[model samples]
Target: EPEALDPRLRAPDLVDRELSVGLPDAATRRALLERLLADVPRAGDVDLGAVAARTPGFVVADLAAVRREAAVSAALRGAGSDPSEQVRQSDLLDAVGSVRPISLSGGGTLGSGGLTLDDVGDMTEVKAALTEAVLWPLRHPDSFARLGVDAPRGVLLYGPPGGGKTFLLRALAGSGDLNVFAVKGAELLDKYVGESERAVRELFRRAGEAAPALIFLDEVDALAPRRGGSTDAGVADRVVAALLTELDGATPLREVVVVGATNRPELIDPAMLRPGRLERLVFVPPPDAAARADILRAAGRDVPLADDVDLDALASELDGYSAADCAALLREAALTAMRESLDAGEVTAAHLATARRAVRASLDPAQVAELEAYARRRSDG
Candidate 1:
């Protein structure tokens, strides 16, 4: 509806005056927040103006999400036991951390209708590694304290493209009731000077405020590419430096964990992979035959498959295929069947075979070898 209207329709004769809605300023956001929270019980420390200033471009829905998150936090903190208990300023700040800005990359907050480990196809080793690195520390803090060992600060998931690295991170995020700020690495890079570093700082500050938070950085290579001799005027280097400071600065990250995923881990700076930084490196390989079958079955859950279709056979045929590749195969097969006959009863093995022939696997042998070698080096370390 906001798209450009036809010239004839835009004329005063056909349409009335148009009013453009822009992002609310600080004062307007404060007014909106006050109105939205009128019925909600809030603590004396809760400042609507502060919340509004923090949320510059938030809309009505985002403000509503903040209120809902604050209420949830209050309930979790034993607010139900006391009828007079109110949502505190800290709860509102944490809620802001959970309610992502409208202009930010990625989607909704994790653990809010997010995918769990069960939703991901078989990746037993990968899942176990993630659990050990993230979930175990979060769920069993006392265990680490007893052993006098520091839990890993960050985890780096490196793998082939579409091999479910990001999916695994999402499952980890959903495993517990944690605040997750998901962002693409390249999205952090800003054209303006100092903006990227400031964004990084703000991101970590929010994560710290929302303790038990998970900052999932997808495509980390773009964010922390190997520094020195950079042509982009050191923007990437500055961003990486800022990220390093956030990860292992004088002020420690109490309960927050940074998870970074990338296909090219070698491109990431060495500083990021240090012991106190993104120390734990987990390799996510391409899906095996079993995982491929699982992916195919999951992808075809809604589609009507013919009895002649053998998922195991299709899986076996999809050698070197990633989970995404398997999904594409199923979609292509469905389309092939539809093209053959509009009234086709269901996707048959023949259709699948045609799709297999048409769509080749996307994995490059050289790249796979490189990833394997990288995994070996990490394992050795």
Candidate 2:
């Protein structure tokens, strides 16, 4: 919250409220946000974290989402109105009643995991890029300062669906001391209007609190769908507003990394992908042939197979499958051997035949093509 640093962004009296809502105390956190929101002004833009100073650990994304719900209910009422019957506290209250705040990502996306460079395998280019972009800047903020360099607000991860986007993210989270906050795009969905807007605020708030935390939004297409494509009218607007404000203006403590992943990267709004917003976009392509053997060996090492089982042949047979798909196939094979108790003995080439025959590929050609097409439609990233 750079606004916190600037002092120029806060109001004179403060919002004069605390999250004091009580709904059977489902979660002490949400209940508190509800209470704080109760005293918030009925109108005007809200700076979530600023508003939530007293409600530490409250998920701002959930609050933003609830806010959207409030807006929608206000819209639905007086559809046939006398135009001057202005939206009121009652309307906001009604929206609140109808909606439920998200309970997931106690912080933000990626569930607050941490990591360093050692946990990953074979993502040489990616590790190099991350170290340069994420590590070097933090390690030498002074160097960056001398160079007149400002850190990136966020990074967008896009790629072939099974190319280890999630795995890479996990590895990033697993790496040392990087406070990871993972947000689920699906959690942005809400029953009412103001809710989504509030969730956006909550996301930034939590991210700020968990400074030096990496906020990972997996399948970000759902949270910040492309401007023209979003079905929810005000959602894109509020999400964009909150997200851009935080990323572009907020002074995140040195350790925070905001990463969003999407299979349909093209669907994330332009403001989100812009240079000043999520400035870095790293595309993870499906593993090339060179990576296939490594992926196979990693997934297959634990399986009890006959010594005669040809790993190279097995890898060859699974050509075109993504790392995830390859793992699924290996799992399917091993499971079959376990199930049939075949030969009451070692699983062999004959066992491999059974597994191959029994297992169907998780992703079909058409689906793969669709994912590929979506990747192609996005920018150089």
Candidate 3:
């Protein structure tokens, strides 16, 4: 935060120019690592490119520190005199883990896990829209350029609570091995003046350093609610302005994609939904019987089900269950089976029936209807 800086320094009339040095990109980081390792005794298996790709928020100095740490480890093991103790890929990776980059201190992580869109339960259209809006630009940049079109800047996912908006984002983060900066909107709120906007700026800065990144703002309504309607002394309004600035500001988003999820889309600032901002609004609806079955099967992949535990039949019985509710039902059923017998091997029909009585659907019918109405209004507009 620039809390310590004099406000006069920020005055355009007083300051003529300002220069900002950002964290190193993947290629620059690789080159820096190569230079640092040029004279060091290292194993042939050490791949700097892989290291560079994995270290998203690392700066040039961070790379140097990693090399220094690795060298220290190698020297402690008598690396200079013994070839067997030479710096290896593991040594550098271990060093990378030991050093924390300043850019990453703001909070974000490099994408990980093996989940893909296929793991999600039967949201074919949602998956397709996410693929086109988020993954295509990073995967097929040339195609976009050839067509003389810029990629989508962002996407908004809104639906009833527990309706799988966040689940879809998890699938997206794993789809392309891109960096992901995940943060809940409410986490950015600060009681101190200017702190919230600084946090917002810091988040985008970290995301930009990690290019081809996805900024997942879960519960984004808290961060960018309808402007001029807050009683918090204009803090929410300022946050909305900051978000608008970041969305279509002078500094282009480049390879970064912003995705926001909220249960209350109607509460979001209208300006945020404008073209070139979070323009692609995708409504995640409650799962139908087939989708509920898919969710049950996916959730119960590890849990053994008895011959009588028909997932399709159970799904049909669950009329208002959200994706999360379906998953919870299976979990509760497993717990019920465990309660019935400590040595129980499989969940039975009776266990599921008992579990259903406990884990009722959480979705509010009126809220769902209101969101559906909001979606219709956006679509018609």
Candidate 4:
């Protein structure tokens, strides 16, 4: 069983001492494959070790299915051939491709979208912090254990909307090989009583099974608002309680981390910001001049540009622009150029200036002040 067994069945009156069987390692998987294919004809090119290396978190049953699929593939390929034509490496690889990992097939999704740290233009400090909070734990677990330190349990990224908080989360998820269970805060709320809490429990359970996984809750304020003053009839409070329990409950979460993003950090329950829950609160401020320049360059990488276009000046002018705002500016610039004439040679400075004038910055002075205050409070705390 991938999940917890019933407590009643574990009583002395019913079951004996329980034994846990974990997923097979590479050597174990190779040996199991050899055992299963002992009677089956396999091609010389077939390498069980390579196949085992590719299939992580695969159980014996999954290996059996792979063999069955491979056999079927071989039969289809070797029609009207000798009885010992054998299953080729290609057949086995195809079978592996067809078989999804149990974690993704059942609960969460795989975190391999080809988005790396490079995809995120700037935010060097934020990227370093995330790496320490997330990647360091998985990469240097021994160092942490030796130092008698517990890795950060959760990271909360708070910033203005369209500041690339979600994009940063996705990049962190894609930086390594891990399972990512992404859920919007609104999606977790249920109309029925207790169902919301149960959903939170199950989400954590799935994340545990897929250890080294990331549980990303976008717009976290929706799920965990300040308690006792909500208009939702205590639904958010219950969900927050459930979330707190899961974050620092009796059962330790090994190789699992929770990441949350919100535009309103002030609205989040203070309990969630405690040491054991979302210990690391990072303020994702709007992109600076260099970041804006990078965003503009990236957005205009393929678009034809005229000699009059000055990215540096444009970046300086768009001081408080978020990443999304920079993208929109570029898009608006292209549209402006297109509107000027059907044969407008390339995007020009005039077009970019018009776009810049049209699209206002999203973050106002008050919101910026609030974000700054929150950052100071976090540091003081």
Candidate 5:
């Protein structure tokens, strides 16, 4: 962004001193909330400490906004006419949900979408592994300290596209009260020298400021490919070097975990996958019949299905359908029912049969085999 400013104003020597103000920690957040709510009429259920703990990335202004939003909600519910009506804890909680923190509104950050791992259909093993590697460290750090071992640094998730890799990230972020900063690997690249490296540093800096965070690097193969073979004026090589440096930087990632997702993990640099980096490599395999059934059920929870429409039978027939494909099938079926009869009350088996022809499977058999082979190689070695 400095590149966008005038040359004279953006000069490196123009500024005398730089001071960085980050989001408030838990104690500060509680104090700020208490001060803000001191004059407001609050119900006994209102707990500032609980609200402070939940607002991890919220700044001073965001906290103020939460108080304001809670008051507005109470007023809308006829608080002005009724003296007993006050801002309840539910109002504050809802206000927190409504207000988006400035720290998370940036391009580098992502919202958790309020989906937990339990919302995910199946992939029992994948969920269990991630729960232990990513969630466990943040939720139960004391266990690691008692065992005299450091928590895991990062995890690498790889599989065929549409196998719910990104979906898993959303679940992971929402599983706990942690911040999530996500960026596509290609988005980190810049033609200007040192800009990519600066982006990496800035990303990590933000993650550190919002401690107990997860930095998700999507499509990481593009960001950190094999070192020596690139025609792009050594920019890719420099980016890889920057990533490696940050992954094992001297400052250390205190409460931050980096999770990289790629469909082609074989293309990533070896150094990035070494110990203490993204060492926990987990393969998100394509959903089996049972998983597909679960996906269908999850996706069609709101869709009115006729008695004849059997998801289990449909999932069994859809052998190669990815998780996304199964969800899409239900969507198309609903549309088919709408088209066939405007007053149709529910999606029928015939509607699903018609929709199946339109929503073909996106999973590539060759890519799945290659990823499976890569997983085998990793396991063997």
Candidate 6:
């Protein structure tokens, strides 16, 4: 489960009151908890609440399970139900508590919509460029650096929204045995001034220890928002500081790769763009014909379609659709077919035409013209 965004996610230094302990046998549970606490608690730490406060890494889920089982037991007793079935002795969860170790400050997963770089069918030049600039170096960090030394520390994958940049990042790291630390900026902030900073320090420290790691930070704007002239001083600032230190610091984890993704790269701190920081920046644009066809095949190869579903014409019409958009359109068509099948009879050629007619190109004609003009303008430059 995700870390609770509320105050529950942050543990306080002290406990507020004595809460009732619920277990199969209170005597054994209390005894075990006291034993664990007694090993670490200072003098005058006599209360159960105090003991709990002292306990680190005590999972709330386990405690909830105990309380739930106890409630079930009580209800069964009132109903004269079978004690064994109501709440078995094994229902009590173990209360083994230990200090939770810290981890990296900024790492999080991109959306796992299965849109890999492979799923992106077109833009061979874009794909090749990204590979040579980012993946090739990552594969042979020392050789690419040409110094028999460390590789690029971090890579920033930034592009337009719905461009499948994040999807590419996930495809690059979803598997293949890389230790990934994913942090969501929206979820990592703490009101306590240094809590987020501490977490950040711990996160990088852990990543170094677990080298050959991938740190993926999504929606980095929350941490590295454009440092304006007059922004409020808060925990966000500390998180930003911690982020810089981790990214730029001379860590021994030579194989560690940091990947930060955002739709609005302009909103990020300018300093991060420097080489050896987020030295590599790859821009993922919308799909071309090859990519659109691949995305459609990947999305709807399994779905039964009529012979009249013109893949070429569909691809031509979907000039500006990203891999994500292509998949969405395919799903929309499939859903329409499913509904039509249930509502009437089998889906036919006319149904596919109906679906295609209903589905509109995401980009306006003006935007397409502008993009073409911009690409050409850059060529002139």
- How many collisions per candidate? 0, 54, 0, 0, 0, 12
What would the TM-score be for candidate 4 when compared with the true structure?
Answer: 0.77
TM-score, per-candidate, Cα-based: 0.70, 0.64, 0.80, 0.77, 0.92, 0.61
Number of the predicted model whose lDDT against the real structure is largest: 5
lDDT of 3 by residue, 178-238 (tens): 7688878887876589888877877787688667788999999999999888898998889
**lDDT minimum window of 10 residues, candidate 5:** 1-10
Runs in model 4 lying further than 4 Å from the true structure: 1-102, 106-114, 336-346
Rank all candidate structures by their TM-score, best first, as comma-separated numbers: 5, 3, 4, 1, 2, 6
Question: Which ten residues in a row are the worst by lDDT in model 2?
Answer: 49-58
lDDT of 2 by residue, 1-381 (tens): 233444543445765443533212224545545564665445443333333332223355555555666556655664677433343555544443344335423535452133333434366777676767666664566887888978775778876677777887777655433445676787776636777767766776655554445677788888787666656666666776667777775645444667788877767887788876677887676666557667666666667778878767776776567778766766777777778875545667776767777665554566567767765665535
Can you tell me which runs of candidate 1 are displaced by over 4 Å?
A: 1-114, 174-176, 340-345
Ranking by lDDT: 5, 3, 4, 1, 2, 6
RMSD of each: 12.9, 16.8, 4.5, 5.2, 2.9, 12.9
Q: Which predicted model would earn the best TM-score?
A: 5
The sequence of per-residue lDDT tens digits that candidate 4 reaches over residues 33-121 is: 99999998887899988888666557788889999999998887777876557899989988976776665676445344656666677
Which lDDT tens digits does candidate 6 get at residues 1-381?
A: 123335553446444343433212223435554454343312232344433332222334444433455445445554655433333222222121112212221234333343345554455655565556546554676676677655667777665566665555666654333445677666677446677887777677656554456677776766676555325565666677678887877455545677787766666777776776776766555667866776677666566766677777777677666666776777777677777666543345566556766666674556545545544553465
Mind sharing the TM-score for model 6?
A: 0.61
| Better structure of 1 and 2 per TM-score | 1
Better of 3 and 4 by lDDT: 3
lDDT of 1 at 141: 79
lDDT of 5 by residue, 187-303 (tens): 888558889998988899889878878899999999999999998899999999888888895568878889999999999999999988999999999898999999888778789
Instruction: Sum up the clashes in candidate 3.
Output: 0
Q: Between prediction 2 and prediction 6, which has the larger TM-score?
A: 2
Task: Give each model's whole-structure lDDT.
Answer: 0.81, 0.62, 0.84, 0.82, 0.88, 0.57
How well does model 3 score by local distance difference test? 0.84
Least lDDT summed over 10 consecutive residues: which range in candidate 4?
103-112
**lDDT value for model 2:** 0.62
